[model samples]
Each structure stands twice: as structure tokens, then as C-alpha cells.
Target: MSDINIELLINTYLVPFGLKILMAIAVWIIGGMLINMIAKLSRKAMSIQKIEPTLAQYGESTVRVALRIALVMVILEVCGIQTTSFAALIAAGGVAIGMAWSGLLSNFAAGIFLVILRPFKVGDAICAAGQTGAVAEIGLFSTTLTTGDNVCVHVGNGKLFSDNIINYTTNPYRRVDLKCQIANGVNPQEAIARLKIHVAKIANLSKAAEPCIEILEFNASGIVIAVRPFCNNNDYWQVFFDTNKAIADTCAEAGWPVPAPHQIEFHKD
Candidate 1:
């Protein structure tokens, strides 16, 4: 190539592209650092306020991601890319993606609603989507729950929003309904009376409401004795497990045996 042509090319294209590339790199580096700082600060602030951890973390991460995307667009413009055309293409892609994944987008929208409405928070035991469990995490698309048996469940936010959500830990107190099956060996009335007394004496039980014991139904096996006890949410699991164990032990030690299965006999002519 000629000397003059080489010089013209460097001035017209090479130098301009190089400068823009350098500028774009600078923006990417600086923008990433700023986004991180903002997220950290927001999280720290929420922590100081004692806000729910799930909400705080989610908010921080979302904001950081949004800012990073904007920064990327700006960097592309600086690199001599046509930002208007790029933006139009992005919009078109987003529309296609949204259409292709409509259900996922619905779940994402429902997740935002869940976070805003604050129906249930993290660590609360809730019944939703035909499953009952303590909420482990609330994500952008699904809510995670840990069941009684330690199973991790991920429920779509769209379903959770549409269905009824029963939050057990919302109030300070929760009612524990325990059923004791009547056996042929044990006296139903006497057993119910004893259970009522035991429930009242148990630790952490709310004294505000008196425990009630009654006969619910009589099945083929035996009668069902219902024991309703109220306790603090913090002590819910403890009270439940302890009461079940205590009642069984008490009945066994006292020789109050459950009856055998009832069977109907038919006579043939």
C-alpha cells in the first residue's frame, strides 16, 4: 500500500475505531463496579432496617442486572454501533421471547406481585399449590418451600398467586388440630378429657384460648377425638411433635389401647 493511503486509513478508520473500543471498555469496567456498589449499599441498608432477607436480596440483584444491561447498551454505542438499531432489535427479540415464554413471564409478573403484596414472607409455613411447607426462598419466577419431611419444592408464582395462600405464621398464634383415633380398648370420653388437660399443661401453649377436646366422627376402626390447641408460631413445630409423642406415651403407659379394625361379616344362605 502507498504511504499516503496507509496514513489516511489510520486517521479515518483505525484510530476512530480504536478510540471507541477503549471508551467502551472503560464504560464496561466502571459501570460494573458502580452496579456492584449500589447493590451492596442497598442490601446493607435493608439489613440495617431488619427487612426480610429474601425481598432485600431480590431487589438488589434485580436492580444490579437492570443497570448492567443499560450499561452494555451504552458501551455498544460508544463502540460505533448504531444504538437505535440495536435497541429496535432488542425490543423485537424481547417481544418474541415474551411470546414464546408467556407462562414464564406470567410467573415472573406474579412473583413481582407476591413481593409487593407481602402476603407471605420467608420462613413462614404456608399451604399453597396443594402442598404445605415453610417458604425457603422467593425467586423471580418461583417460590421455594421446604416441606415437613425436608423436601424442597419449587412452586410457580403464577399458580401461587391464583390459588389460595394460607399463611400459618402470619399471626402470633396458630391452632394445632390433633386427632386421636378411638380404639375398642380405650374409652373415648375419658381419653378426650385427659388430652384436654395435657394440652393445657404443655409448655408454650397460648393460655388466651382454652384447649377444647371433642368427638369428631366415628369411623369403622373407632371414634375420632379432636384436640384443638393454640400456641405461638415460634413454638408451633415443637408443640406439635411434643404433643403427639406425649399423648401416645401417656395412652400406652396407662394401658388405653386402640381397638382392632372393625369388619362386617356376611352370612350366606
Candidate 2:
């Protein structure tokens, strides 16, 4: 190439454009490091505030992704690219992504609300999204539950939020309701007194609260006795099982039997 043409090439394209390219590269490298530092500090601050671990992780990831995206735009501008066109392209891409992941976005939003509202937390035994289990992990998209049978269940946050959430651990105390059907001939007063005594013997029952044992409704089969026993939340299931077993044993031992269904048969000619 001629000396004049070589000079023009270096001056017009190589020098200035190359410098901008180098600057953009530098910005990308430095920007990444700064973003990382910011994310680290944000996590530390969240931890100091005792934020939920799942929330903290999601927050850090979201912030980091946003910062990286912003940094890329700045780098593109520095490289003499039209930022307006890039922004338009980003908007289009974002809309497509949003449409594609609408369900995921909804779950993400629901997860954020869950983290903030805290209807239930890790280790809480709850009934949500039509499943009963103890929460193992709360994630951005879904929650993990360890069921009573030790099965791991993944329930979407959107569904969990939309449905009824029965948190067994919300209150310190929970009531154990036991329905006992006794024979018609058994003395109601004696049965109630015996049931109350049996309930009081159950483990983890609150001594402060008196159990309400009474005959609620009677049918042709038997008398329906409502046994309400209050116990700590952690010991709810234990009390429930124990009370049921105690009731059956007590009735059997006292000869106050639960009557068999009286079915009548007619002879046909």
C-alpha cells in the first residue's frame, strides 16, 4: 500500500476505533470486578439483616445480572455502537423472553412475595398447594417439601401463593380433635370423664388448657364425643396419634365398646 493510504487507514480507522475497542474491553473487565464486589457487599448486608438465605441468593443473582447487562450496554456505546438501536433490540429480546417464561416470572414474583410475607419458613410443617409436608427449601421458582413419608415434593411458588396455606407452626399451640363414637348403652358422663383423663395423660399436652370432652351429636349408631386437646405445635402429630390410641384402649378396657353396624336382612319369597 502507498504511504498516504497507510496513514489514512491508521488515522481514520485503526487508531481511534482501536482505542475505543480497548477502552470498552477494559470497562468490561473492570466493570465485572466492581459488580462482583457490589454483590458481595449486598449479600453481607442482607446477612447482617438476617434475611432469608433463599432471598439473599436470589437478590444477589438478580443484581449481578442487571449490573452485567448495564455494563455491556456501556461497553457497546464506548465501541461506537448505536446505544438506541441496542436498547431497542434489548427491549424486543426482553419481551420475547418474558412471554416465553411468563410462568417462571410469575413464580419468581410469588417467591419474592413469599419471602417478604413469610407465611411459612424452612422446617415448618404446612399444607400448601394441596400437599402436606415440612418445608425443606424455599427457592425462586418452587419450594421443596419433605413429606411425612420422606418424599421430596417440588411445588411452584405461584400455586403455593394462590392456594390456601395452612401453617401448622404459625402458632405455638395446636388443638388435637379426636372424635370417639361409643355405644348407646354407655354412660355419657362417665365416658366424657374417662376421655378427659386419657387426654390429660397424652405427652406434650398443655397442662394450662383444660381439654373439652363432650358429646356433640348422637346418631342411631352411637354418641359422637368431641375430644379437643391442646398441645405444642411441634408435638401435634404425636398427641394426635397418642390420643386416638388411648381412646380406643380406654374404651376397650372399660368394656364400653364401639358398636358394630346393625344391618337388617329380609327374607325374600
Winner by lDDT: 2
> Which portions of model 2 miss their true places by more than 4 Å?
1-44, 52-90, 93-96, 262-269
TM-score of 1: 0.77
lDDT, candidate 1, 1-269, per-residue tens: 99999999999999999898889888989998999998899999999998888899678868887898899888987887888998788787997877889999899899999999989998999999998999998888899999989999999999999999999888878888888786865687788877776766678888777776889988878888877788987788888887787678667766776666888899999
Poorest stretch of ten by lDDT in candidate 2: 255-264
What lDDT score belongs to each candidate, Candidate 1 first?
0.85, 0.88
* For every candidate, C-alpha RMSD to the true structure in Å: 3.8, 5.6
TM-score of each: 0.77, 0.71
Instruction: Give the total clashing residue pairs for model 1.
Output: 2
What is the TM-score of candidate 2?
Answer: 0.71
Q: How accurate locally is residue 49 in candidate 1, as Cα lDDT from 0 to 100?
A: 95
